[model samples]
Target: MNQIKKWISENIVVLFFCMLCIAAYTIAGQNPYVVASDLINRVMRNSIMVLALIIPILTGMGLNFGIVVGAMSAQAALIFVTHWRLTGVAGIAAALVMCTAVSVLCGYLLGRLFNRTRGQEMITGMIAGYFGQGIYLLIFLVLLGTVIPFWDDQLSISTGIGVKDTLNLQEGMKGALDAAYKLPLSTVCIIGFAIFTVYTGYRLWKAGDEEQKAGRRGRIVRWAGLGILLAALLVIPVTSAVIRRCSIPVITLIFILLVSLLCQFVMNTKLGQDFRSVGNDIHIAESAGINVNRIRIIATIFSTVLASWGQFAFLQNMGTFSTYTAQQNVGTFSIAALLVGGASIDRANVKQAFIGVVLFQLLFLLAPAAGTKIFNDSQVGEYFRTIISNGVIAVALVLHAMHKAQENAKAAAEAEV
Candidate 1:
């Protein structure tokens, strides 16, 4: 009973949002299949971006509002990709590669800046995103044709001075990465193989066998082998899902699962231990000989790179880009999604990312319909969603502060005793 109470106290904000989602779903009276299907797709699409926020939070850096920088980096890559007229997986791959490079560079810089403003990382990130957007607009609007020099007439304005306001992926990039293959049977085989690899790894480690005797080096090699195998399995399914056109985003779900598993796996590594240590107490970690600044930088880099990929994944599916504005809300929504999942200022995970996406998106899908029913105004639903999403984030922050305050009070009382 005490445990249940503690859990409730910890997750009150999530529970409240969950209730709102359920209420909205009930009131909307939408088809269950459609709603469920939409929710699943949304989760698959948005979860990665949210997952990207988890690592930085785990490192005690708070939610990475600078993920917008990563999103912008992706959009910049896609523009050149569309200009180059690269099609199919090649185009998407090119974009991913480009975004990865850009994000890594940007993440490294941002991480360095963050190290200076340590305690204010979140607010600093938010500011950096806004500042970055200004630079993005300047680059795409003014610098691209003149300074950057690209050859894609299709991607530029009539005067061929700047990039287009919208880039349609349907022509070249839509479903490019997604439509790489069609092997449902192969997908299942890969999943089974991945499961087996995991099981085998667990058993071998448990047995303290020859592999364990080799220690971290052997474990690293084993993990590398397992990761490669699992990645191969992911390819079979994700590529196949596009071809099969399953009701659910089967391949996308697999992608999310892979990412989630990767997130968990990373947390168990030495780096993850360092992150936990830094998160717990940076001063202590520093005294313990951990490179606090370096770890924080690495965390930001990972978050930015992952966020870039996540944004690209989303854009490919949507088949269009608003260019200038697409990245603006990326950070906000991703952070909100993480907060909605019951993640706090100090801790988060893939589970929170998934749950937040589901609950938050459910309310999003249902709000307009429910609003139309209740107020005979669909716009009411729009306002409701906007207000609620932002509201939930505010509430979660307050709850986090309160929880921290309570903890401090309890510690002080214990000290007095």
Candidate 2:
């Protein structure tokens, strides 16, 4: 009973959101296939940005709202590529290269700022994001053709002194990654199950005798689940309308999967261990001879670079870029999505990030329909989404503060004893 209560306490936020999602889905009464399709697209577009928050959180840097700078980096690169009339994969590749370089520099500066404001990294990050946006605007809006000496009628203002408000990527730049390859949704599902089955079997085989025995039932259940899922995939009709209509963006998903894998792999490495050490206790980490500030900086840099790439993918998928406001909500939305997945200020993971993206995006998709159904006004849903996004972050911060206070109190009691 105590364990159950603890579990609930730990995951109450996730449980509440899950129930809320179900209610929204029921109220919306949308077609499952349409919902699934929309969810998949959103997941692909935003998952990387959400994942980028994990490392910084793990390093005790909180949600890294400074990632908006990274998004700005991506937009800058995209602007350059678009002006150069680059197209397709080559354009994306070039933009990524430029984005990486720019984000690294921005991240380093932001990291320094974070070090100066250690315990206040979250607020500092938010401020840094605003500062970066100001600089971004000044460059593109004021310095483009003047100090920068850039000239493109389509991209530049009438006076040729600055970039335009919107940049169309309908050329070959749009869907550059997503359109590279496609597979039926059913095929993707089958492949996913097959991979899971093999991975599960491999884990079982690799476990030692005692360990294997301890987890024997759990392993068997996992294998059974995989088998059932695979069998269903095989038996499901390929001629089904949904299966035929819905397709997966193979390359885009591969990129998302690779980022997910990278997140998992990094957390198991030495640097990742340092991140944990520093995050858990900076003073202890410094005493242990770990450069806590450096680790935090690296975490910030990693997150920034990933955010840049994520923003790049996001814009490409949309096939358009809003010059001034494209990156405005990157920080708020990504952090909120992460929090919605039940991650705290100091602890997050790839699974939580992905789950959060799916749920958050699902809610966003359903909000309008659900609102229209409930209040006969779709605009209410938009307002509801705005509230939920901002509210989730606010709520998570309060919960984190309470949790930290409880821990500190318990520690104080122990020391008194």
Candidate 3:
């Protein structure tokens, strides 16, 4: 009874929303298939990004507003990608690489800056994102086409100097990655594998399997064997025309797998230990000979760079960018998605990232449709969604603060006792 009560308390919001959704489904006449599919896609795209927020939280770095700065770096890379008319997975790859390099460089710079303002990391990140955007816009608006040389006339505006209002990569890059796989099968399979890998890694960490973690060569061997088996399973699909459909799914799956593994690896490194220690006690970390400043710099750089890749992933799907407001409020939506993914300031995990995306996106999927059915107004649905997403994040932050204060009080009391 206590366990059940605790679960209910922790997830009351999810339960209420879910119950509301079921009620709406029963009341409204909507296709279950479309709703489910849309919800699934939303999860796939958002889960990875939300997972990005989990690490910093684990290290007690707070929600990384610096992530937005990374997104800007990606957008800058994308300006050229779309301009070149590279549509398929190739385009996505080039853009990711470009954004990554740019983000890494910028991330290092921001992280260093952050080292100076340790207590105010979150606010500092917020300002950094804003400042980064100015540089992003300047490069896109000015140096891109003329000095950069945009070969793809299709992406250029009627004026020929600026990019078009919208980018149409449907013919070029639309489902390029998705098209590389076997319709929906590879898509699900790849994501499933990625999820499984992360889960396994989590289990390893939780069990405190130092020997297993230390066996780097053994892990590589196992991966190789698994790869051979997977390749065999994919033989028939490859022979058929289904190979194209596997492209996006394969790439996306690989991307997720790499990030998850990267996270796992980082947590085991000396640098990772530094982050963990800093989270526990900054002053102690400094005393222990860990250059607390250097760690902060590294973390910031890594976070922003990854954020840049996420933005690229997002824009590639949108197939367009507004010269004026392309990234205007994407930061808010992304943060909402992360918080909705169950990430708090001090603690988060891959499980939370996944579950959060599912729940958050379910609401997103239903908001317009649900709102229209209930309120008899589509615009009302939009209004509710906008308000609720923003509101949920604020509430989560407050709740986290309250929880932390209570924990601190309990610890202090125990110490006194």
Candidate 4:
């Protein structure tokens, strides 16, 4: 009982997420398969954006509210793709190349500005987003068909001097990735679970070894037991569900998993180590002869470039883009999703990102139906999710601030002692 209590305490946030999901499922009473299918799709679509946040966080830039700039860059490139009538993978590739170039420039400028105001990166990023939005508006709303040479009647406004408010990609590039080969959920789940079990066991064993080196006895057994329990908890029910013969977009799933794996791999490289050191203490890193500013710039550049590709993926999957407003909340919801997954301003990982996508999309999937059931209005659900998403971000920021305050106070007390 005490062990269960301790586990609950350690995982209170995840527990709350589970409880909310249960409440949503009960109140909404939606089709289980439908929910699962939607959850899978949304997870693949949004995970990249959320994962993009990890690098900036690792470089000590906080939540990187400036990712919106990268989203904007992608949106701009998307306009050209739509205008050129580029279709399928070709369209996505063009937007990626264009967006990467734009994001690199934006990230470099933003990084240099952030260096000028070291501790204020988040605020600086937020301001830069707003500032960049203004420029974005000028380019698309005014310059696109006017100063720039765009000639697509379908994409441009009737007045022929700007892009339209919304661009549809159904005929051009929708489902390009999702239309690839399908896979049985059971096979994928088994493979996934096997990987999870081995990885979890290895992590626990390493932790146990570290504890032993520090003179903590019996930790190995405890860690092994805990890891086994966690692995079972994740695998058993999920495997059972998979055996029901559901299907997934196998190619898209593989791509997402590859991206996740790439993120983990990057963390083992020299650049990743520099990101960690700078993240932990920029002053200390500088004293160790690291190029602190250069590392930070690289981090932002990677984050921006990743966000661009993520946005491109999102646009292709959704089949439409609201030119004026599509990217506005990219940073907001991605950050909220990351925080929902158990990431913080200072630390995040791919597993947390995927988990966060699942949990966040679960709420997104059920909130409307639940709202309609209780209030007799489906629109309530839409409003609820919007408010809740922003609310989660606000709550996370406050918690981070409070945690920092507590740490500072503890350090001061220890110094006095």
Collision count for each candidate, in order: 0, 0, 21, 0
Q: After the best TM-score superposition of candidate 4, give how far the Cα of residue 37 lies from its true spot, in angstroms.
A: 1.0
What number of backbone clashes does candidate 4 have, counting pairs of residues 3 or more apart or in separate chains?
A: 0
Output the TM-score of candidate 1: 0.84
TM-score of each: 0.84, 0.93, 0.78, 0.85
lDDT of each: 0.82, 0.88, 0.67, 0.81
- Give candidate 1 misplaced runs (Cα > 4 Å): 170-172, 177-246, 409-417
lDDT by residue (71-130, candidate 2, tens digit) is 999999999998889997689889999999999999999999999998999899999899
Decide which is better by TM-score, 1 or 3: 1
lDDT of 4 at 73: 89
- lDDT of each residue in 246-307, candidate 4, tens digit only: 67777677777777777778788999999999999999999999999999999998888888
What's the ranking of the predictions by TM-score, best on top? 2, 4, 1, 3
Clash pairs of candidate 4?
A: none
* Backbone clashes in model 1, listed as residue pairs: none
lDDT of 1 by residue, 1-417 (tens): 989987887888789888888888888888765675577557767888988999899999988899999999999898888777788768867998999999999999999999999999999999999999999999988887788875576778877677888988746677554444434444545666677668767766675666566575665577678778656644686544442343444566567778888889999999999999999999999999999999999999999999998998888778898988999789878888888888988889877888888888888788889888889888776788788668878987897788778779989999999
